[model samples]
Target chain A: MVHADSSRFAAGMSTKEVYAQVLEQARTLFDGQRNWVCNFSNTAALLWHAYHSLPAPSNAVNWSGFYFTNPSNPRQLILGPFQGQVACQSIAYGRGVCGKAADTKVTQLVEDVEKFPGHIACDGASKSEIVVPIVKDGKVVAIIDIDCAELNGFTSEDQAALEELAQLLAESCDF
Target chain B: MVHADSSRFAAGMSTKEVYAQVLEQARTLFDGQRNWVCNFSNTAALLWHAYHSLPAPSNAVNWSGFYFTNPSNPRQLILGPFQGQVACQSIAYGRGVCGKAADTKVTQLVEDVEKFPGHIACDGASKSEIVVPIVKDGKVVAIIDIDCAELNGFTSEDQAALEELAQLLAESCDF
Candidate 1:
């Protein structure tokens, strides 16, 4: 059930339903996997399918992945598992959307990446973005980062769903 | 130049040319970064674009990634950075293509995965596979695993090119 066949999102599924399945599948995939590497890797793949399986905005997602808190340097976030083109290897705390999320430990849902001050363009195709910090034991462990090709690609419902997924990741991973 | 923009594979390129560019770009990407996690993650993305940028069997690739030797359990390969659906969490040495590569420290290129005894089907869509071992200090550290949708997906050229990549990884990564 943890393999790829079990992850296929059926046709005509709502975005809410898609993400719901994503969360449920992620939970099933990562149930006993405590290693952050494996968990984040599968999470990225799970998000990739969930978004592409939908229509319009969510289907336009160009990237879905994680930026883990570098153990050697907590102030910097290191690129982890991702489903996209090559990305920025490291982002300093408070530098960009990802950094802001990590520094503030709050979700950042930007309608337009270009308009976000000091945005780090990992992919030029990314028009909108969302980042949710994964907090464990009162400290940030990692962040879920998603980028879409359309402006205002994500809604508050997405944030709510992803935040719940973040909560799941916070408890699921050993990072 | 480490960003994703530089990863674009132009239209109308040969598989050999694409891989050459992949290797060149990978060297530049990994120039200053020694962490295996980042290197492997970016490498997967790079390969994803490279293969999809090509035609036929190469473009049919559904999975590209690495499975690192578990630090605590050397005989097992823990899933690492990847671009695909959720994959198997771990494969024991000599258990499958990835495992065989790790166990033998040699590249395993199978035209049809089903024909390969003891193959592990992480994705049912994967019909062919290639696994290249990254050897460090005369020991296997990790393996590059690529899966494709059609039979006879990989060739001797792919093996040679990825063997060169394995050498690059062996030298570049700390792990």
Candidate 2:
């Protein structure tokens, strides 16, 4: 089992209902996923689809998951876990939160889309975000990102939880 | 020019005429060798040599430096930088200031080594000590160590200066 919670499993739920339900489930799931959790647009898409289709859903919503036009020549997010539709695999530094995190070596957590200075709207529905830097040897190697549809969805508990997760990832992956 | 001042240069000079003259000349030459500062051992060695050659040289001297042998392997401070011949490279966490700094991720400046519980004595002549951790990604990666012959050899100013230098190295080096 890849660690799923029964509490999030709801009966007689619509896709939107499931989306709402699973997200709540995912909060705990993500927290338990090795103390760090990140998702690309694809992962985001998969999450969206999974949320929409509680038990068994269609792939329609899945297709529209993580999609971002590359601002840099070679845009990719490298190898990590993701969901939803196919994502632009590569991204450049200073382009996306993924890129900017690489460039600045700083963790970025955006609570609202409108307030984000350079908001890259991969999915207009995503309104909140948390990006934790995975650093090694005094350098930022990668980031663990989580996107949410609700505003102010992430809290300090989320931040602390994710930070610990990031540390675990850095230690395990040798980042 | 790689940021060297005469006063700072003099801080690294020794009282011995031969060593003082050599350090003075080395300061000028060191400008071009900025990129050469690598590894905890190398920086430790440089600081050790510099401290030993200070203007007001101590009569009784003791010195040692520490390195992280296991990146994830906790509980040990492998010997790193030093000036005097006596050294204990490998020390367990909770044993000495070097190990304790790594354990606590806090800088430790002790006026007298004797007062510190579990102080590991690589050199019996050492009466005072300072230890600063090199932190990255919110974790302690290494430490800058200083040992002196005189009691209360390290002041707050020395702590601050060494801390600044340690941070510089922490930000500059890869590991």
- What DockQ, on C-alphas, does every prediction get? 0.73, 0.01
User: What docking class should model 1 receive?
Assistant: medium
TM-score of chain A of each: 0.97, 0.55
lDDT of 1 by residue, A50-145 (tens): 999998989999999999898999899988899998998889999989999999999999999998999998888889999999999988889999
Put down candidate 1 lDDT per residue, B52-77, tens digits, no spaces. Answer: 98889899999999999989899999
Give the Å error, residue B116, model 1.
0.9
lDDT, candidate 2, residue A64?
A: 22
Model 2: per-residue Cα lDDT over A1-175, one tens digit each:
2122222234566655544443444444333222211222112333434434443222222212222222232233342333321123345567666567666767666667678766665456566776676665665655666666667655575456556645544554422
The deviation in Å at residue A134 for candidate 2 is: 37
Interface root mean square deviation of every model, in Å? 1.6, 23.4
The ten-residue window of minimal lDDT in model 2 chain B covers B1-10
Error of 1 at A144 (Å): 0.5
